[model samples]
Target: MTLRWSTLDTDAVPAWAELTNLLAKVDRTEEYYDAEDLAEELSEPGFDPELDSVAVWDGDTLVAYSQLRVSLALTYEGTARAMIGGGVHPDWRGQGIATRMFDEMEPRGRELATERHPGEPFELRASGGLEDDPARPLLSERGYEIVRYFTAMQRPLPGDPLPEVTDPRVGPVTPELAEPLRLAHNDAFASHWGSAPQEPEQWANGMEARSLRIATSRAAVADGEVLSYVITGQWVDRELYISIVGTRPSARGQGLARQVLTASLAAAAATGEYDLVELDVDSVSPTGAGRLYESVGFTPVRTTATFAKADGAS
Candidate 1:
């Protein structure tokens, strides 16, 4: 079979979404995106489709694709992170399509990282589905090590007893609180592994995503300062995804995170538009976030692993 290779553009959205949803079902990743969602991603801040993405097709059928992105901000360790993402169609899996895609992505990731953060150390990172994901062996063979695991947890909406948000400080997120919440998010995730502050543009992209449900999102504030927040969005039908949940360091032990999260959950439940609320948390969260979610009735449904390879200058 003769294969055609080209960089991605707006026209690739339909094929990309088709292959992605297929992979989701075959891999049990539960990640599904529509053409609009894929288009939005292709337009993310700092991502140049022509330079950062690639697609492979056999005649008229798209068989595989890959994307590379380097963070705009450096992690707390002062290291840049380049993330690789994409998949090969299930029917085309064993034909070395994935390896070929990675061969092009890895060096480009390094180049992008060096250009973005000159002279700094960087890590090439990729995440895969469950324990036995096909990509795991390829990642391992390439010297990537399993560095972290994240658990996807969920609770049925309107049925699970949610904690009451009695604090006067907690309320639904508002347009006026956007900037404050962004600042709070950066501060809250400062020490989390592989996390970096989201510059204004990146933060805005997320806040403006079509799926973001401001009415169901909640935040806590005091004296005009945002202390904690829970941002919710929907990708899958009848499911509310908790996109971000954080509390600034100064407010850690006050249970503010729980307050805002529960507030968001309660708001979503009240909507009666969702059947479940879902979120993924670091398995070994520094703030004991896993326990907090569990206390709120979220049960683990699956886990994904992150693999990393150190690269670039020391």
Candidate 2:
């Protein structure tokens, strides 16, 4: 197939889905994209579809693609991070297509970073699983180095032990409580590595995403304030994923996180709608999130490494 390269166009949505399905099959994971998901990414705050994304086509079919997302981080360095992620079709791997894709991504990322924060420090980051994966070698060859690790964990929900909780009122996540949940989420993750509190606009949009099942998610409330929350969402028909979980710094040690998580898991189990619960946690989080998850029966099933290319690197 003759290959053609172009910036994102309206016609590439289905082709992108096909590429994602191929990648999911190769990685033994569920299909990660649909048209709605693609649309959401395009609509994200400050994203420009044409300049921030690229694609490779085989005649009428998209064979590979990537997106560059720029987000400002409020760390001590006040860094701007440009994340580039995408994949080549399974049958099209090992043919230098990914290199071509990154050729488009890296320069675009730098341009985006400068646009977002002129004369400020920035980093180019990408994430992937497996040491032998093609992206690992490609990123490393491009001066990217691993900076952090994140673990995807899973726990069987059917017949699994659920923890007991007595304090802190826990209940479903309703529309009225969305703002409080957003505030709590921001406060909870403010100290996390490479994280920045979500802008109010971004937080509002996230709460409206189709993937988040607010009715099934749980939140801990105390004195009319949301203390902690476990944002549950349906990944597939058989799996309930913890989209995000956090406890307010002031609310830690009261088991608010555990209590809300248990409520969400027990609800999933009681409905007999899911076979497993899954979540991702930073491996070296100061909050000990990984250990807290392990205590609730979540076992690490996969590890993803975060790689970065520093400015002025080859």
Candidate 3:
């Protein structure tokens, strides 16, 4: 079979989305995206698709792809991380297509991380849904070790009694409070595993995501400072994805995170546009975020594992 390998470009958005959604179904990942959603991602800050993305095509059909992105700042361990993401079409699997994509992605990821972080230690990270995911053996064979697990949780909307937020400071996120929310997020996640601060451009990119539902997203503010936030977005019809939930360190224990999250859920249910709300949390979160989510009626749907290979590792 003759195959064409090329860097990703704007013209490939539709084909890319088709392949991605197909893979999601085949892998039971439940993640779905429209071409427009992916187009926005291609334009994300610090991501240069021409250099950091790869697509494999047979005739006019996209069979596989890979994307690499380096963090803008070092993690708590002082290590730079390059997140590698992509998959091969189900029918095209087991043909070494994924390996070929990784051959290009892994080295490019290391180079990009080195360029961005100078002499800082670096690792390449990737994740797959469930313990039996097809990619797990491939990653393990490539010297990648499982480093973390995250659980996807979902709560049905408009059904259960939502938590109450008595603080009048909690309300829907506003355009004017975007920057403050970003600051709060960075501060809140500073100590989390493998997390790095999102620079202004990255933060703005997330805030501007096509699916972001600012009307249903909630934030808590005091003295003009954002103390906690719950940012929600939608990729599938009738399903609200809770993309971010955080409370700044200085404001933790004030129950601000729970307040904003519950308020966001209440607003979503009030809209009558959603059937469920979903979010992913670290399975062993240091902040007990999983318990908080469970308390709010979320139950685990599935768990995904992250695998990483340090630079220069055999």
- Candidate 2, residue 202: Cα displacement in angstroms equals 1.1
RMSD of 2: 1.8
State the lDDT at 223 in candidate 3. 90
How well is each residue in 22-48 modelled by candidate 2, as lDDT tens digits? 787686545466666676777778778
Candidate 2: count the clashes.
Answer: 0
Off by more than 4 A, model 3: none
Worst 10 residues of 1 by lDDT: 305-314
Considering only N, C-alpha and C atoms within 3 Å, which residue pairs clash in candidate 2?
none
Write the number of the candidate with greater TM-score, choosing between 2 and 3: 3
Candidate 2: deviation at residue 146, Å?
A: 0.9
Instruction: Compare the candidates by lDDT and give the number of the best one.
Output: 3
Worst 10 residues of 3 by lDDT: 305-314
Which portions of model 1 miss their true places by more than 4 Å?
312-314
Cα lDDT tens digits for candidate 3, 158-239: 8789867888989989999989988898898988999888888889888888999999999999998999999999999999
